[model samples]
Target: MDMKRSLLRAGLVLAVALGAGHLMQKLADSRTHTAELATPQPKKIEKVSAGPQAAPAPSPAAPQVALAALTAETPKLPPLTLLPRLPVLAPPAAAKPAPEASVAPDCTPRLSLTATPRAMITLALNAPCAPGQRVVLRHAGLVVAERLDAKGQLSLDLPALDDAGQVSVLFSDASITTASAALPDTPLPRRFAVQWMADDSFQLRAVEAGQHYGDPDNVSTEAPVSARGGYLISLGDPTLDLPMLAQIYTWPADAKTTADPVIEAAVTEVTCGRDLLGETVQSRDGKATVTELTVAMPGCDALGDILVLNNLAGNVTLAAQN
Candidate 1:
């Protein structure tokens, strides 16, 4: 019994062992099939990873394209060579200067005089006067002498004429005669001599010793000599007539003389201011008529010797002496 039990135990043990071995073999076979199927799927997944990995690495190259796009975003600038240039022109020339003009000449007249001590009077005749007039000397409203020269000048020698009183001298044409008288007066000779005052003026007095006589018969011893002719006779033949002498007496030794009497007579006296008279009376040199009478009497003021007479228009200007 013990032996049989031992054998039985042994067999049992062998059967269990064999059954375990067979079960192990079946598990191994199932594991091998699952491994094979899993292997093929793993290989497919590997192929998908490899193909997608190639696409991802190619996307990294897109950053280089992005960098090129960033460079294109900036604005571009143009070159400076397209600017335009300005043109230059020449300047204009300067203007020329104007020329100067001319002026007219002045024909003003002048007079001068001098006196001496010996009472022998020396008279000087000056400009703008006709060369054919006579100079008559008077004292105390009495005519002392007459003088005429070839150049319308007069010179007289007076010794007995008193200088303490005033003397007057008048110039007039010698060829004149009184209209009341039919026959003309006799032509008187030239040259005369008489006494003079201390102030160089003439007074009614006798002729002096050194003086030459012009009219000896007509002379008075108490009064001054009445000489018919003197130096003024040499001027020319007179053409004026003596109607009535308008005499003006002066004060005692006033020391004033005037040539305005001549100018005033020619401008305002009688018919001298009239156009008919100026045309009728002939000028000395056949020049313009005596439309303007100018006088220059030295040592005389208040009235100048300038007389501008327009007989045609009857206009006159008697300027005051300066």
Candidate 2:
């Protein structure tokens, strides 16, 4: 009985072992079949190895230029030639001047000009002390000069000049003395004036010429009418343009034959160009008054170079306008 029991136990254990082995085999086969039916999957990474590469494309060649064709495009130039030589003539020699003496004349100052004593008798020459020294002077007018001393001395020549503007002295040498003088001032311009009173009236008649030309007031007669001295004093260069002035004393109706009251002169009739100004001046004797008239004309050439005076008085001597 003990042996039979042990055998039954061993059989049971072997059967169980056999069943477990079969189940594992089925599971492994099913897994493998499923894997085979699925599609292939790519790997997570790829690697490159040393291998051959594609060849590069060939490059095109550059176009070539021709040397002969380039030379033909250049411009041609003219050929150069040698110039002919010309003869150079020499000039004739000039004549030489003769040699002069080596000695030269002395040029030392010994005299000077002077103006000192205004009196003729006091006149003296200024020079180095030489008791018997000779002195000289030259002038158009008569004069006298003499030497005085070695230093300062005052002297003058007699009858300096006929002209008021001139004063001259003579000397042997100009360097012996020196002098100075103040020239006189220029005088005011001179002119004459003609006048007419408020009661007087007249028209421009005709021009008067020469001395004693015509009456100042009467132009109806038309006799010789012209200009004369001091009638119209030229203010400018009278020869070119007659710009003049005048001073005329008004006269009373009865003054010609009898004593008339002293009165102021009224310059009315004036011709030079046109009226410039009018003023009053004292009479020469200072006893009465006078009129100083200044006037201007269109032009001396424009007015026939003549002034026609017409007024109440009979025609008077004509005076040229400036």
Candidate 3:
């Protein structure tokens, strides 16, 4: 019985040792499988054959992404600001023109002339602003100096020297006025004229063929208008300074008796012991002759005495009576 018990204990010890060994071996194998699952391994490459074969279709590309969908994840910005507009301007206005000034009219002197009878001319002057002025009248070779009236007017008659009458007047201010006319009358009668300066120093004495001194047919300065012979016309303004004086003797157009002319000088206070100057104009047969004359005066002692000039006036002729 003792031997059988010892053999049973040995068998049990051998069985426990075998079971522990098997358990340790199974735990080691489980740890090795977990490690292999955590780590990856590289894929292996395979070689193809050298012969030709059909190729496979390629795979499609990936689709593109949209901008809205891309920017949806970015931050947003604020709106921009704007400025206001300015106003426009216009142009300036035009300038105005200036006005013109006014002027006055001119006032100058005027003269007029007209025709008259008997181959004469009528000169009329009107100078309202120039009164009492001296004026000289001229026609052909005859000149007469006179003065304007108190009314600044003058009217006179002048013998026409030309068929187409040409007359002129000269003023003291050196202004000249002229006129013209036509004279178609018959010839004038025989005339004798004498022009002198001193008033009472000279005398023209006319004596008919058989007339005596102081007779009705005698003509002299004292008796200018004679009934039986020629008449006399005197012209002058003695009040003027250095006056011009004239005397004319006109014989009848149908006279049968020859009338002689005699010039006499009487010494006076104004013409004492001085030479007397004068001009004589004789018109006959439609023609005229002008002669300048100078006469010597006596001494102042014989102031009232008369001196006769013989050769002053030439001889006179008359038509024979039937």
Candidate 4:
């Protein structure tokens, strides 16, 4: 029983010793905590001012430090070099204005007039710039329209109305050329022309002292040149669009010759039922007289008949015979 009691006492003592050691450890931890609390730690203290704070001064080496940092981080580059300036050239002299196009020597028309036999004037025209151009020929009071040849040339004989012959050519562009010629002094036969617009409506007939009314010896275009006392010459081309028709009658200028010139109208289909209008130009005693006339035609029933108009041309009598 004593041994049991001793063993029990030993267990109780071990328990008390363990409890005391636990209490001492807890006391030591408490003291350490309290000591740490009692000691003062270093703390940053900030001043709270009521006014605006001044900006801090910049560091002396800040720029150099930043420059060094930038130089280290950036890659090395070649040194810059400026290219040589190019010479400025004066703008090329204003290109000499191209010489104005020269005018052709033959551009202007050339006109010439020459006296010819039988009191006629020869008209010559050279218009290199106006090939095949229609032009109006004006002489005294007479006017005629004709076209130039392919080579811009024209040559024609025109009866001289005046001793001092002056002719003018008018182009469609309103440009005109003029020329004059002196006619010969030789005496010309008494002549006259009957002009009309109709192609074949009018006929000029001259009855000489030895000729009958319908005889072949009467002066007509178809009569033989020598058989008839007077001669008839037809002028103008009937093929033109507006053909100008003229029938010229010439008689001897001698005082002994007596002649009766008449204008006859044929009653063809073209003039059967229409009136004909015409003009007469007579060159007598170195003077020209122009007269307008209108002849009444017979109806269609008289298609084959011929009407003689007496007053159209007066009787030709020399001054010495009169």
Candidate 5:
């Protein structure tokens, strides 16, 4: 036939170029197994063109896959709005009590003595007294007396007091100068009473009975009831004119007319018999006269020569003054 048809067209071109080189080695062995299975598989992105979409650049694997999904996902946070408050106080009160003071009382008493009577009671010391001081007689609450040397001088003993009362004597040491008196209750008379007679040529007479006369309203019968003739009489009752009597006289020292009349002048009632001499004259009718005087007398002492005649009846007559 033409050569046998030219050898079958060269085996049909070599069978079509061996099938196109086996399909290009099977598409390069499936692209080397898809790059070894995409080398551990994490690349899957598919966002084609959603208009305006270009933010894809951070990939070191996309920062390790967004730090492992931000360390495995747990954070959405926001909600707590401001908070804090606490404080309040009040409580306290209670306290009180105090008061009391007042004092005064010292009755005072102490006094007892034996012999101290020269009479001296002058106490004056209104404070500040020391020296065995003890004196009390409040109103007879009796403690009586003390105080010897420290001289606030107190030497008492006038007690026996009867009437005029009023006494307060207190001084128990701190010398408050205390002492008072107003005593006087009848009992201070030892006798003294006479009346009348001045002279009949004075003699002597003094006889008081039941003596005990002190304040006969302050006595002073003007003294002088006769002592020596020149007369001074005031016997305002010295106990009833010294025991009543009369006239008497005797003068005969060998009288040769010792100047005449020796005793003459008589009346009745005669009881005058106690030795009398010249210058005797007692005539109120009771008769007596011996005054013919030869005058020779000097200091005569015959228990006579006394002429104190307080006449005018205040009776005081101690006659005999020759």
Candidate 6:
């Protein structure tokens, strides 16, 4: 009897425990039903009007965008390309140079000349400018240009021009030589150039048969110059038209001065820039006195280049063109 009572009590306990579990389960179900009521499922609405319809409301939470779907919908981009790196190259080797040639120093010419008055000129090249260099010598109005050999030593042989004048020699550079000499056999009727001043004084530019007078102020001059039938005439002649006194340089006392003193006395000379004076030589009772000498004037052709008149108290030498 004790054992039966124990078994019935155990069965009652088991039944109570099962009833509690059933009640808890019913409560959980009730709570689930309440939540469902609070949030109802959506129902489709019927369209009212056709024209432009209002926009639909947004859903509570937008559907999560899938990574693959987003990637598919997005526009494709250009593919990226990387440039390759360049290599550093080495420079080329330098070439060998050629041997240089020797050069000479700069040589300038130096010249010297010796001229014996009235004789030819002697030229000497003291300094040689270079190989195959040239030198020039000028005299009167003529030029003599010559070249030198490698040695630079050179000499020039030329005929004499005038008894007393200048000769100019020029080298390739700086050295210029001027020489003067005297020669006994200088040719004449030489031409003489004259520069006359307003005061009737004159200067010699050149001695020539080549003198053609330049334009001078047309005024009267008392100088001992006369033109006979157009000799040395320029700008209507500016010489004395009568016999004038003039001095002759280096006149010997012994030479027969007047071939015919009385008749040849009617003359004029142009030299040494002296003015004119008409004079006479008179001898009364074996005594000579200078009287007023008058005679007929003759042209230039009648007399020689040299007109020597010595009997007068003053000695003067004159020149005329024959």
Best-performing candidate as measured by TM-score? 4
Off by over 4 Å in 4: 1-105, 198-200, 227-229, 311-322
Sorted on lDDT, highest at the top, how do the candidates line up? 4, 3, 6, 2, 1, 5
Candidates, ranked, TM-score: 4, 3, 6, 1, 2, 5
True lDDT of residue 104, candidate 1: 46
Model 3 agreement with the true structure over 1-322: per-residue lDDT tens digits: 7777777777677776777777777777777787778777658867898887778877887888867556556666676666666656566666666666665433244566676755557778776666898877766556677888887788877655555567777877898877776554656667777777645445676776677644665787678766654766666666778677776677754568666666767777877788888877787655667887777777788767776654344743222111
Better of 2 and 5 by TM-score: 2
For model 2, the superposed segments whose C-alpha errors exceed 4 Å read 1-14, 41-322
Per-residue C-alpha lDDT of model 1 across residues 91-152, encoded as one tens digit per residue? 66566666667654332212222344422234444423545445455432224334344555
Q: Pick the candidate with the highest lDDT.
A: 4
Candidate 5 residue lDDT tens string, 1-322: 7776777777777777788788888889999999888888658867586578679888565334334445666887898876655444444444444444554433333233322222112233322243444444322211223333453344333321212223455554343333344223233211111211222122322222222222122112232221211111221122322222222111212223121111221111221323223222331111222222122222323323323332312232332333
Error of 1 at 158 (Å): 2.6
Better of 1 and 2 by lDDT: 2
Per-residue lDDT tens digits of candidate 2, residues 130-235? Answer: 4423343332221223343444233443212211223333334544332323212322112112322222211223222221323453212232212221111111
Per-model root-mean-square deviation over C-alphas: 25.0, 31.0, 19.2, 17.8, 28.0, 23.4
Question: Model 5, stretches more than 4 Å misplaced?
Answer: 1-94, 101-133, 136-143, 146-160, 173-322
Task: Predict model 6's lDDT versus the native.
Answer: 0.40
* TM-score winner between candidates 3 and 6: 3
TM-score of each: 0.21, 0.17, 0.57, 0.59, 0.15, 0.23
**Candidate 6 residue-wise lDDT, 1-322, digit = tens:** 7777778777777777777888888988998999889988779777687798779987799678777544546777899897887877777767667667777755655555565332335656655555545555554433444555677666754333344445665665656766665443544221211122222222121111223322131111322232211112111122323211211111112233211111122233432223323333222222223333222334544533323333233343343333
lDDT of 1 at 304: 26
Total clashes for model 1? 32
Q: Write the per-residue lDDT of candidate 4 for residues 1-322, one digit (tens) a residue.
A: 9998899999899889999999999999999999999998769877797898789987676444334444556777999999999999998888788899987665799999988877778889999889988777776555566778898989888877666688999987999999998664756567777787735457787877776667867777877243434666666555557766677777754558877777778787888777788877787655677777677777888777787765345543211100
